[model samples]
Target: MTKHIARVLAAVLLSIWAYGAHAGDVIRSFNADILVREDGVLDVTETIKVNADGTDIQHGIYRDFPQYVTTPDGTRYKVSFEILSVTRNGEDEPWEATDTDLGTKIRIGDQFQLVSTGNHTYQIRYLTDRQIIFGDASDRLRWNVTGDEWSFPILSASAHVILSSGAQPFEPIAFTGSRGRKLADAVATVSGRGATFETTHALDPFEGLTIMVQFPKGAVAPPTTAQLSDWWWRDNLGWVVLIYGFAAVFAYMMFTWLWFGRDPKAGTIVPRWDLPMGISPALMSYIFDGMNRPGFTGDL
Candidate 1:
């Protein structure tokens, strides 16, 4: 693989993850090999299995590179493949043409004229669309396995298709999911307290719509957002229970602080003490003044 193809492999792995944007919609099995010629043209051969039982599997290969996504069924579903150049043995040929969608065909004589739909799927050997193309054949190519391809869902149903006999440079993405979760404009309610490990569940080839997860560490298992509290109760009743309990304690404390136990001096005093009001300093002065019972003028 050329450096460009190597980088594109990373892109392809990510797109496989995006194919899982909607779970249960489609399930796919596939294998691909990337080839780079001395001319900077890239070729990819693939064998794909679609999971549409009794459903006709129709697929198209787009020569337009870099901006597309492939469906789970291995259909180049989104984006357009527009070819720019075609060459053979270092010589230019009139075989090259422009297309709004899939570019001119170099091998099949005519574009879309010989496009075939079969019972299962197709295996293209040199299924060329553009400089960047992927095809597969029933004849498996004994290529070297550089490393393990990563996938999710723990147990994944896989289909292995041979790439090319000779191995170029290849970089394998470790620890991939069976599919992936796609990010788009949507509403999501996050109730749990842990991290949600975002991963792609499967592979997509055409749309160039890839599922990429940003991890501080390279391709580790996704972090869980599953909260213990969330598993504890319906409506998060456990959380509610804790809140109510705290409130109850607080209310009790407030009541005690406000009224339950207070200093007698904190309230207004009543005038009905056992001691007569005249004896009290508050009224004694007035009472004595009013009594006018002054001591007999010095017994005069």
Candidate 2:
């Protein structure tokens, strides 16, 4: 029937339009600069250029940072991430950070606002700890420069890792591919106390660039005990709040019962009926109520 054929055509047109909305947005460039401080913290700045189409990218973009890392021995460690600032086109932008199952997601944009279609530049400055591995001979910084799982393709990506002065860095390596792939399609270069990496070709969606740099031992201090405790509390704060709330409620109930709900102390009884002013109820009511009362006047 003609009606049935028309419905099929409408369905096909709708699917095509939906796909086009997402397919038009792309990452023009992604650049990251990492500064390895001597106090075991890494200060990073990422400048991301996005070419968004109005259809799907009306709000803004979100960046995700992975949370946990497991060693060969199966020991898992949580990485600490703190956002310093986020700017769009050289001005402050509204953003929110939340912990997701994948990691930390920094969502930038206002729900009530819409970003115009075209190129927009975003700069994110943040601090992260527990990203370095200390070894006997050297310390290692293996970081995923451009995180995988982006829905849009990236045309170019690069990173620069800077260490302190007088520190020697060697054995620089770079990998480019999807997660868990070792495709060596990138170049890593080491200078005096820094390492730089760049991808050789464009990265499709779900592809990323990971770089590594090894420096002399003791270049950066290991995390202290206090830092470890802080990270632990950060990871388990939900449980801590829950327990604290229950304890507070229980303490309040116990205090209220002790102060107000207990039985009164036993005392000797002294009975007296003086009406306080030495006036009988019948006379008081006859005077105060009405002299024409049925029984109050007679009793008085």
Candidate 3:
């Protein structure tokens, strides 16, 4: 009995030790490079390094980039997310892109494989549109470089926002902490047509890094209607086709009703009490009035 109790206690302690090792995994580095194009497209690349211990980081990491935003005036617009490539540790890694309620989720790593325990680096390249908010005086870009949904603490994070050639940027700012905290925890600097941000302290779990930069008017153009429509159709092809099919059907039915199904104008409604020379009273009632009365054959 004594030996059994000792063994049981030893097993419990071993389980606790194993759990602690995996629970302490952390994100060592997160770096984002964003380029603002003159035609309103943003090319972004992210390099993320994680210290994995085979817990939640089993397969690999998933990055989320939002695809829409609602303005203060209750208008919602689309932001397109087009993935270019993904690599892990200098080699191409298998990945897939999916649309979720949150945004475009790029799931990196093969489902059949498990990531080795230790530090692993992932590089993701993607293109996005409508990330710039064009204003009358300035065009502003507010980007969440490292999203706030990570389950682990970020030891270090940074971002660099670069503009097109010959265009200067201004008012570079960065915020760190939970969403909407506004507490400044990073330093921002402007060099030439680019702005850089680096965190002053390590970010806790659920905390993120957001950067903003402003450009002079006409530096970044607003997306044209053709571009917007193209994205809309690509993202929602099935729904758009279904809606248009229903609309076409309704239009055809309405046209047929107006052209061929409607009755002729009621003969000017001459007021006369006497019946016609050859028409009987019952026949007149059945023809002029509806066929609701008994023995009415006008409908046939």
Candidate 4:
């Protein structure tokens, strides 16, 4: 059967009311749309929305910059597993496809399973033309997760038909998500009683992103992968080191100018205005010592 039908069955089986169910109960839906476009043409705009009771399979492949979406009750995820090989196809194309063993390192059979009991750091390196597959990785998933890493599809496989369709003003591509959901933000012209709202949102970096999604209620929740943030201002030792480094440089410059500077050591003598007559440090010391003595003083 199709992925959508399988997802629906899974949701039904999982949500069969084993006990009293509440609104917050989580369910998965496999055939949810997950792409969108902004109204403006200048940008590749897309917004993703989340509303679901279960987790499902969502897939997409695009060459332009990636757009992301997460929901209050639902979380969106992308999984990666990529392999490379070389092949040559033609001479007229100016690109060779016949060479085997391209730069891809991931093999088709290699699998990733994270059975972490607590928060753990993971290194993920994937290279694919564009495809996301997340499956069977969570349970032994351990860290309250049951899913495993997914497949890295071939380059020619566009996740959705929209990828190859080029850009259209009204056509927005969707990325399927969990639990009978569909989400995509594309360039759209809404016909209203009078006018339309056409705005564009910019693309974002694919790596190292921070997403804050609040639940229907105001919730301060973190991602499934707990990542901590610490500012440099909070690090006392770092601050101390920075301050000392600056101070050392300043002190060196001051000493250089006062003692061993060009004018002093290079014979570029600086004239001294002694006020014509003045007691030296040595002279002052001698005078001060004599005055302290019990001798008859200066005049008497």
Report every candidate's CA lDDT.
0.33, 0.87, 0.86, 0.25
TM-score of the candidate numbered 4? 0.18
TM-score computed on alpha carbons, candidate 1: 0.24
TM-score of each: 0.24, 0.71, 0.72, 0.18
Point out the worst 10-residue segment of candidate 2 by lDDT: 291-300
Using TM-score, give the best candidate's number: 3
The root-mean-square deviation over C-alpha atoms between each candidate and the true structure, in angstroms, is: 24.1, 11.3, 11.9, 24.1
Q: Which TM-score value belongs to model 2?
A: 0.71
User: How many residue pairs collide in each prediction?
Assistant: 34, 0, 0, 52
**What is the lDDT for 154 in model 2?**
85
Summarize candidate 2's per-residue lDDT along 113-192 as a digit string, tens digits.
Answer: 99999999999999998889888878999999989978778878999998864576789999999998988889999887
Q: TM-score: which is higher, 1 or 3?
A: 3
Flag the better candidate by lDDT, 2 or 3: 2
Clashes of 1: 34
Lowest summed lDDT across 10 adjacent residues in model 1 is found at 138-147
- Higher-ranked by lDDT: 1 or 2: 2
* lDDT, candidate 4, 1-300, per-residue tens: 699999998888766752233232111111111121111111111222112222221211111222222335685322222312211111111111122222212221112321222211111212321121112321000010001122111101011111111322222222212223322322223221111121122111121111111111111122222221221222244668899999999999999888877563365768875432677866765676966755453765
Model 3, span 30-63: residue lDDT tens: 9999988889888999999999987678998877
